[model samples]
Target: MSKIFHPVSEQEALAELPRLRQRLTAKARHAHQYRGTEGKSLMAQAKRALRWHQLFVSINRRACQ
Candidate 1:
């Protein structure tokens, strides 16, 4: 499958921040709850969390400038 990319506008990024934070929180909670379980999708959750976190930081830095 081909990867899909959509460039985020400043306004769109600002709007997405809250939703992304919420999803990150939920994913984190899921990962924590399954910490000791084997074969869990922890890696996937971590990747998503990282992606959202990076975007969030980038947006904040841009806003501050």
Candidate 2:
């Protein structure tokens, strides 16, 4: 199945960064504590999301400056 892509504006991305970071950290801790497949899966998904947000934020920041 294909996933639909929705573009996020720089401002929105910036605002969401903090929440994404917090989620990633929480997922990481849970994964470490549980050492279970579900935790690992969730942590991986969070990492992917945060990576995307970070990349978008960095690229946009550079472009705008």
Give Cα-based local distance difference scores for all models: 0.62, 0.71
Which residue pairs clash within candidate 2?
Answer: none
lDDT of 2 by residue, 18-61 (tens): 88788788778768666558877887788788787777677666
Query: lDDT value for candidate 1?
Result: 0.62
In terms of lDDT, the best-performing candidate is 2
**TM-score for model 1?**
0.45
Which predicted model would earn the best TM-score? 2
lDDT score at residue 51, model 1, on the 0-100 scale: 84
Model 2 collision count: 0
RMSD of 2: 5.7
Off by over 4 Å in 2: 1-16, 26-36
